[model samples]
Target: MILVPGLWLWRDPWLQWAAGCAGAIRAAGSQPVWFGYSRRVAWTAFLRPTGGTAAELVRRFLALYDRVRARHGPPSVIAHSFGTYLVTRALSDFEGARLRALILFGSIVSETFDWGTIVARGQVTPARMRNEVGAHAAIVRLAAALRRFGYPYGESGVTGFQLDELSRSVNVRYTGPWLADSALARYCRGVWVPLLRPTHPPRRSVLTLRSRELSRT
Candidate 1:
């Protein structure tokens, strides 16, 4: 299993998720390797007005992929939140990466997901009783439309946008702050705990580049 933790969550005291995943994989009789990316390589970076930083981060990810594949066979990748962005970018980097499985949790890829069923299940309520419309209805419509015709953000010419298509094989498991229930907590505890307690925590200063711009000042 290839575990990837979310942004800032990859930092020690926050990277418990990766360790937890590793443990789970071990318990299931499989060896897991943690694959972490810098926080600056966030999803928003891909959409920023100046996407130079995101482009550079993508290049670094490609280099990391070379090393990981050389050491480990194309393995099952598990990504959460911001790290999901990296997983998508990396998959787009190589065609024959041999991804066994992709488990995505707390997904931040789309602003809206399946909500019709969520509302029927009482997961959310209409903002105004009189309006009779869930707040996230619009986003669900957008996601539906995009999924129908493939990715909507970029054209075929775009380098990284191609990863959006891989969702078909990627097993997505979403855990929103809204879904703060016991079952959800237990399912994600493994990923969340170890990320919070790392043996060699990364320095916060290591994050010099921001997703928004190249200028640190």
Candidate 2:
């Protein structure tokens, strides 16, 4: 199994959350690999998240995945938060490549994210944490769409976007709001940030894109 951590965290997670996960997999008689990365930008944890960071994470994951696969055939993957995006992006290159499983924890991926398009050559077990949050306002949804997926700005009345997507086993669906519907959500418009920032760049513009996803109960 391969373990990955979230944003603002170093790729080398042996001393962090990866430690527990790696140990569990080891006790299960399966070997675990710790991926390494330096989430450094602007020399602060609050750096703006950019696509470059995600891309780099994906690159590092692929490197280790390739090495592990060469030896162990295919390795299951476990990732949390932004690391989830990294794994998703990497496996996408080998769409439909069968592995043991792909587990995600506290994933902040967008609603429209195509989980079915994940890397799996066979029926892969998917799991995630699910907490329910109310639907978002039209403007909140609109701003998130613009920021997360880079949707073009236009007249869109989409009030809520919800998906209880079945994920690869070993994880949970993250239920967090993309934008808090309050005095801030009203004017927190035109938000944008590169993947290089802290979470995912939607929030750093005015809020944290690594937001509590608006989930369907």
What would the TM-score be for candidate 2 when compared with the true structure? Answer: 0.53
Expressed as tens digits, the lDDT of each residue in 1-217 for candidate 1 is: 5566554532441334455445556664556666545555554553451367656655665666566657654455565544555555555444444443445453444433332333344322222101111212333343334544554222111111112332222222233232223343445345433332323433434345463355644
The residue-by-residue lDDT of candidate 2 on 33-69, one tens digit each, is: 8775565631121123344654555566777887887
Clashes of each: 10, 37
TM-score of each: 0.46, 0.53
Worst 10 residues of 1 by lDDT: 126-135
Candidate closest to the true structure, highest TM-score: 2
| Alpha-carbon lDDT of model 2 | 0.44
lDDT of each: 0.43, 0.44
Please give the RMSD to the true structure for each candidate, in Å: 17.4, 17.3
